[model samples]
Target: MQIEPFTLHVPQTQIDDLHRRIDMTRWAEQETVDDWSQGTPLAALRELVRYWREEYDWRRCEAWLNATGQFTARIDGLSIHFLHVRSRHENATPLVLTHGWPGSILEFRNCIAALTDPEAHGGTAEDAFHVVIPALPGFGFSGKPTQAGWGVERIGRAWGELMRGLGYARWFAQGGDWGSAVTTAIALQKVEGCAGIHLNMPIARPQPEDLAAPSPTEVRALTALQHYQDWDSGYSKQQQTRPQTVGYGLVDSPVGQAGWIYEKMWAWTDNAGRAEDALDRDAILDNIMLYWLPAAGASSARLYWESFGSFAAKDIDLPVAVSAFPKEILPTPRKWAERHYRKLVHWGDMEKGGHFAAWEQPEAFVRELRIAFGKMR
Candidate 1:
């Protein structure tokens, strides 16, 4: 598979359309949900919409992202957008970084500099890495997967190919959220050149009772898993069952689009209500616009159905490290992780950070990355 390169070019017309939609937004009543639990509140959406149109600057944000060496690549018929940041030193470890739902390569914004240019970021020059930050197959500029079989595991293969294509014979891997699971797959499945792996969030689901003894903690994990099914997983259900139905609403209104995307970000982050506590306002909007501009709000959701329907996570035999945060919805205990990964190390109770650890806490994020993967280097 060959990769493609793209100049940073966001058209002016799209920007106008987004602002126009924001201006024309007809908001709804705030049916009270004390916090952001129900969804993005109409009040907050209105305020954010106003700021996006009046205060936020698209070209400025685009310029910031453009500095990261963003480019496009074709692998197995998919066009992938990725950041290929090479280190100054020779023999730098290559690390493939992945992002999750409602996230982009933006999650790794702070960690990227630290990982690639370690010496500058207060690390040993020996800890340098050539980082590969890919836009997930359907999520961003990579374009959507039209045919079947582009589940999480297949995405893993595409990433491994991406790394090898870049000429890294061996590399380390790290991720948070869905990225964690994909990195998990890469490490477990023995992707070519994957030396070791690290994750902030663990790929978690209810385990069969017979597979291992369920501790009270494990039982609590199960209950939380079940609660997601009963209460919090409406997005998964809609995405899995009727994505197109929701897509129509998302495709039309930027306010509606904000509500759909922002709520997940709110719930997933360690913040109380403001995602800005962890993410930049423009950064959050950029992720939403990636979906809105591509009109991929529906197609991207199909990934949930695609991954869940067929390729579930397997018991992987690889060196794996996981950093579980307090707000992590999928808290895979060490024992549970041990059952799956043959070589499990570096499991820690993160005092801060939520699903998007790289975005939330980059220094601590880099510190953890250095601890787990710095060994490989």
Candidate 2:
């Protein structure tokens, strides 16, 4: 693997073009709803557009991100962007931190400092770990795979290679959303290079044995799934079948992009009313900008269409830890996940974070990961 510096500098033309798209956006009519429950209410998007065009400053945000040791690696012919910050602790274990779809390397920015140097950040030196936060293939600075079948398993294998290329023989892994699925693949294969695994968004689809117990926890988990099937899966359906169609609106308009990203942030965070209360608005815009500048809005969504169905069928063999947040659409019960993971070690029902736990509550997320992996140690 060849490592090199990676940074973004959006040109004047692209910024102007983004503004024009924002100006020319064709608004779709919809009834007033609570915090974009109805697919990014057109009105709220329009307001967001104003801030994005006139108020938001991308260069400043980029500079702040660059301070965190930005770099790129050509892995399997894809250019992968990541922030690598190693702990000073000589005994710190190498850990891979992977992010999911509709997200970027930015998700892990908050936890990097604490995870890498726990002793300096009010944590035991024994809790330290060398953290590798990689942007998934095609989501950000990472190269977008142009062909098909580049699923979670492949990504997991790539991660294993990434560690070896960096001269590490073993590592712990953690993921959220698609990242969780990738961790499952790495763990199931018992990747000799991987030592333990932790996940936020479980990618193991339901199995008969998983639902067999019918315990209160299992029943509640099933109910969540049933509800997700009814009211929460519109984005998945579109992404799976015709991501290109959905991409057209998202790439062309800033408001459209904001709405697309905002709905997820709102639905999946530890927030009650204002998303800003939980997620930094600037962070949200930075993620959207990654999609907008690359025009990868559609290409990324195709991940769902291409690989999710098959990936959902396999079971993981390693010990796994899961943290479930209340507002998430289909949070699996701990007992249910234990069926797939033979060595289920830790489970947490979180009151403070949702889908993007790594971003919403960095302290809690890092603490959980340390505790989970520390047990394996």
Candidate 3:
């Protein structure tokens, strides 16, 4: 496999065009309700748009990514973009962190330094990790898959190969959302050199037998799942059934793309009132740009159409750790997770955090990872 160094330098003309679009946006009418039940309110989006056009700096984000170190490797005929940050500690373990839908490698940016240099971030050398954060195929800087079959299973296999290709004989994997599904697949397939896995959003569902005598946690989990399926799953449904249709609006309209993802950042995060409470305004916009600038709205959504239904909590006999964030779209209980992860090693219930664990709560995210993987080490 050939890996080439990559840097992000969006053309000046494109940046100018984005600003022009934001300036000329045909405004939508304000919502009747002051809350987010309908969707991203026009008032909030207007404020975000104003800030985005006048203040948010893409160069800052680009520079940060460049400084972090990035490369693109052709794996299985597709170019894969990833961040490779090696710890100075010689005994650091190799670990791959995967991002989910509506997220990119940017999600892990804040945690990288802390994770790779634990001694500098209030930890001993034992907690250090050689981190590899990859952009899922058809998202961010990675090449889009032109054909079908690039599902979680294939991506898992590719990750396994990626680790070996990078000269790591053994490595650990961690992820949330779609990334969780991919990580589960990696463990299920017994991917080469996969020592263990950790998940923030595990796909553990109660079996009929288990549900027959539901505990309080199981009941709460089932209720939450039902609520998600009823209200919060419109995006998933559209992405699963007709991604191209939704992508047309998302790719052509910058505001459309921003609204699509921004709503999720708000709805999913453990915020006091606004999404900005949990995440920085600049950070939210930065993540949206990863989709907008790359025009990845279609390709990214297609991953769901390809693999959403195929994901489940299959039994795996490997060291598994889970951090069950309370505000996740669907929080799995410890008992539910233990059913599928036969050799469960670590299980933590985080007080705060949501779907974007690494981005929303980096300190907690890093702490969970170090503690969880500590058992494996």
Best by TM-score: 3
Question: What lDDT score belongs to each candidate, Candidate 1 first?
Answer: 0.78, 0.79, 0.92
Question: What's each prediction's TM-score?
Answer: 0.92, 0.93, 0.98
Number of the candidate with higher TM-score, 1 or 3:
3
lDDT of 2 by residue, 45-70 (tens): 66667788889988877787687778
lDDT of 3 at 135: 94
What C-alpha lDDT does candidate 3 achieve relative to the native structure? 0.92
Off by over 4 Å in 1: 204-223, 309-313
Q: What is candidate 2's CA lDDT for residue 179?
A: 84
Best by lDDT: 3
Native RMSD of candidate 3 (Å)? 1.1
